[model samples]
Target: MPSVEATGAKLYFEESGYGYPIIFIHEFASDMRGWDAQIGHFSRSYRCIAYNARGYPPSDVPEDPQSYGWELAVDDIAALMRHLDIEQAHLIGLSMGGYAALQFGLRYPERVGAIVAGSVGSGCHPAHRDAWLRETSVPSRIFVEHGMVTMAERMARGPARVQLKYKDRQRWREFILRLRQHSPQGMAKTMAHCQAARPSLHDLSHQLSDMAIPVLLAVGDEDTRCLETNLMLKSELPNAGLWICPNTGHAINLEEPAAFNAQVENFLGAVERGSWLRGFPATATIPSLVRSRGARRDHSLIQIDQETEGADVVRLHLR
Candidate 1:
């Protein structure tokens, strides 16, 4: 409904359900309503929280691009978690949200119980960014510099196909139109931050291994944006599980909510049973999850081994 002040800007957010806490973050140009399906499903057993990040609809729009950087966005999340007294929450983010969540988890490891990062690769890979810059940059810059409809032709491609498959032409049109209304400058700033503050989880690999927190990494099989990145990440994140959804795209959460929710539900169940966390209860030592791995030391980088369980084999390199 209404937004709250986390740091300086107003962030729109909604809370629903009534069990273990789960916070959902939306992608660029989209708001908390993106989680409508997830809230409906997960609210039945888990407390679901979805929020609009700064510079999005129903949220404050800061003029300075610096104000909307990824690190700042990550800080906004951390502040919100503290403001809401959410000690530990399962972090679920898509695309830009994924990058923000990763930064938040690295900064406030104690406050995160588990993490589900979709449609985002291990941050800052040159090839990944290059591809994104080509396919996404023009549209992003057009939308930001000129106007929303500058690339309406391009934006319609994915949403149009989605409408055909589901027979929801009217709804699809509205969704795309709403995304078009987003501040072009704001969206550009968000993208710039994502590219500039890109983080490497490689150094944190061993730290993650020791944390043993349940992590589920997912990407659309056809999503050229983050598929290989996720594959690379699966190898480094020791306790992480990977899923590649078929017939999907970069916007997998919106394009395939059923599969997305199922992956989240399964991981949450494992978390409850302490199977994924290796008997290390979330409340007992979440901060310790990242800390237990101790200092970083030189270690051989692990490579992808083979394909297993629908995901590529990832070798875990512990330092």
Candidate 2:
């Protein structure tokens, strides 16, 4: 029941355990409950906080569409941190939340310890920008006309979500039930303004190229919409490491919680040990691996070999 006032709304957040904080942000189709698996695993060693974003129940839902935006989303994270008297915390966000985490790190570099961005960059590609905008509005209208039950069922079965349905039917059912409880009006406005109106990740390359915070960019191999954009993010962000889960989809955490949790713990461990290096060296060569046509299906992990000044090769493993 704990809550914090953030910008124009109040955000409901839950926390457990104690230590350096780790904040979890959910995707559009989920709420703070989506982070249950994370909180259970990480709370033993780290303070885990997950919050319901504005427009989700237990958080204030602003009626005006103008109240929802990418900037506001970024500010909400800051506001929560400030409200809790946290100087800095590791941020982990998924999909919509992932975009906010990246933007937050960019805007407030000094306040971030590290970032785990999962299943992001869906509508950010220029090639799919128009189609994304068109498709985004369809859900908004659906919510307004039919309500959460209809929208939740439809969205739960989306191509990017199929993996979860097949991998864990019970978990997928719970996710749909939670999604069905969201506010219809809040969802409608969020879909229209926040998701569809946000700027493309391609437009932020200049800023991402200079970011100094350690970032782990994670996405599912089957999440076709985000695959290319995540690759672009890895290339642009000097301090970013990428992870692509095999046979997975958009909800990587839910589909493969053990793998997702292990990868994150390792990243955080490296950061804590000061072993996480800065961006790739200026002379580092990133080969053109992606093909021009059709998706490639190589199970071998994407490895980047970087030769440091001491002639030691640092291998970056993207699994």
Over 1-319, each residue of candidate 2 has an lDDT whose tens digit, in order, gives 7999988899999999999999999999999898899899999999888999999989999998888998999999999999889999999999999999999999999999999999999889999999999999898988989999998998899999989999999999999999999999999989999999999999999999989899999999999999999999999888889999999999999999999999999999999998888545343323334222222444333556566456665664534
1-319 per-residue lDDT for model 1 (tens digits): 5567766578878898898899898877467777788899999998888888887767877777667676778888877787678889999998778867766776777788889988776344655555555655555566666776654435556632353235445545766776777776666666665544555554455655555456788887767646666876777665678899886766677777787888888887887787663221112212333345462333322232333345654443342
Segments of candidate 1 deviating more than 4 angstroms: 130-140, 158-171, 195-197, 200-211, 277-319
RMSD of each: 7.6, 8.9
Top candidate, metric lDDT = 2
lDDT (Cα) of model 2: 0.90
Q: Rate the local accuracy (lDDT) of all candidates.
A: 0.69, 0.90
Highest-TM-score candidate:
2
TM-score of each: 0.77, 0.89
